[model samples]
Target: MTLLTYLVPVVALLAQVAALPATSSAIHPRAPLAGQFAGDIGACPPLPMRTTVPTSVKDLRPDDFKAVMAIGDSITAAFAAEGMKLNPVENILENRGISFTMGGDKGAVTVANMLKRFSPKIVGASTGDRIVSLCSGRLCGIGGYFPQDRFNAALSGAKVENLDRELNYLIKTVKEDKTINYQKDWKFMSILIGANDMCDVCDGTNLDGDTYERLIRAAFEKVRINLPNTVINVMTIFKVSEIWPLTKNELQCKIKRALGLKALCGCAFVDGDTASGVAKRKVMDDYAAIWNQRLLKVVTEYRGKYDNFAVILDPAGGNTPLTQFDPSFVSNIDCFHPSERAHKYMARNLWNNLFLDSTNKAQKWPKDLDNTIYCPTATDRIQVA
Candidate 1:
């Protein structure tokens, strides 16, 4: 009858509520409208074979050699300077992957401008000049672009309606740019786009998830036509829910409460809608998840279409249990931008999946240690201009 006894019962009830199962269509009418994603989540067909997650593949060597280019938005632009540390080149393919920018913006981004920037790099022909070319034959490049690339050409405020325009612009750019011989020089292409489309449209009056699949398919088709000989690598999106949890959204709360009542079950507990105190750190992680899945679909489809093309999953494997690594060793922090360590990780992951080479496990890579010996104190976070 004491406080301890009363609290025990309450805690037990909450735990039981959390464990309940959930059943519903992936997208509801109140959710965002994905032109093609509007089918019954249960009845919708499994994603095409091309969408399979990437597994270990050959290491790309320095000799796999050819021209290359990179394209996308702020996330892609962040690759320069300290941003490179976010995902290291060594972690990508083994040898320090040679990479240089084609073009990118910090805010909004789209595929049209990406094609324009990327064209110059591929035709710049030289052996080491080939940037991060994974496959060899002609020029090859990888674009870990933000999802907005799939839709709007302007990259300002993207939407599903803009997808066709973006694709056509890429095609037209390749056809018109005389300096770069798209047919003669281009050999391989890697695409990582579409996260923003979902992030922007996830809530509101239209709640269909079917359109996501359709738009992706159409984009791939455009790639097939525009770059015929190129081997395309597609990477599936990693789990962002770990970084950006779903239950945190106001819209999600309504769904949880409704489901709990409609199904005669405690959906709030199971869906985590009632957890009043989610940490700030946890919320940031969940936000990352929301954006992750959007681009992953694009990567999967590209890989599934062609044999020479490859698929990579979780470029930053979540199992590592570390978010931001030390800038000096594994990371280079430019504000929120990745440190050198992080870039190295990205480079190695790319190398492992496409290139055939020994793992660069013996490099001067930093340990996952946060020991006081190497760890910085309060002084590190301070800045003076």
Candidate 2:
């Protein structure tokens, strides 16, 4: 059989997931926050949501931030940039002609980037101003391709194993600085981690589900203790497996995979066209599904405990086995990372979810694209040195 022959079972599996009727429960446009996720291999539910600003729905300008921070790998870094592109790019919603940091060049288009919408002077380490780090600090999510830095121990390319330490470091440093006064200033945090953990399993690194849960719990519990009143928005890991399936149609990606330019190639497929490789790929996809549910479970459990956390399901939608991403959602530079458009999509939807509580389609995050607020194209954005 040709290499393409393996797609049949995958297609069948998806039909089963989609054709099944939608089950009823208290469907909020948000996460359960209390009970289990009702997720099965073929019945994963919507991701969760929680946004506790402690600021009484008041307008939050960038200067209003006592501090905003993040923890994760490159995906999280997309918003927190250093001049080096690998530093951290957690998102500062600014409309300056250029985004002067690592992940920008495209823009600080993270969920936090949505702050730019409300008019805030978001600042960070690179700003060289006394109020810089006081406004925001993306202390984690440095860049390096998946599997390459999946399990690194350095502060350079942080992973799940490293998040708690990073949080501790951020807390210590923020505490030492007299500039931050927690009573009047609010803290916001975003954690888009675990893609590397999923990549680890895809690339032969160990990922124990129970251990992963423990790590997640440990990180959040630490955050709750150190930054007790912080409002945290946790984005769910993208379906890394979906990238592979959609990616198969792209000739350049296929050629790169055959020529050894892509690491995710191993993640989507195995050594050859043999049945074993196909089976392995299926397992990998199942792993993503299981873990996505696990993430929902973890967040819900913690929300019941902390009340400050929320999960951003692939707010772009089309993430389930039955659904897929629009090609424009991923970066053209590498089909792996989210595109600038995708980032704006998250910023828009996440903002809406936090701002609204209804599940109605109109009330859900606005699915419509608004390029007027910020340009979504890569070429349209000006790159700053």
> Considering every candidate listed, which one attains the maximal lDDT?
2
Looking at model 1, report the run of 10 residues with the lowest lDDT sum.
376-385
Off by over 4 Å in 2: 1-65, 79-108, 116-157, 176-178, 182-184, 202-204, 269-274, 304-323, 357-385
lDDT by residue (1-385, candidate 1, tens digit) is 1111222332332233300122222212332222222111122232222232222212222212133332222233222223222233321211111121222222111121122222323332111111222211121112222332221122212233344554565556555556655654434344444323323222232213456556655666766666544444443332222222323233433342343321111111223423422332344334344434544555555544453333333333332333333323221111222333343334333322332111311112223321111111111210000
Identify the candidate with maximal TM-score.
Answer: 2
Per-residue accuracy of model 2 over 353-378 as CA lDDT, tens digit each: 44322232122223333321221221
Q: Number of clashes in every candidate structure?
A: 64, 11
lDDT of 2 at 356: 26
Per-model lDDT: 0.30, 0.42
Indicate the TM-score of model 1.
Answer: 0.40
RMSD, model 2, all Cα superposed? 14.2
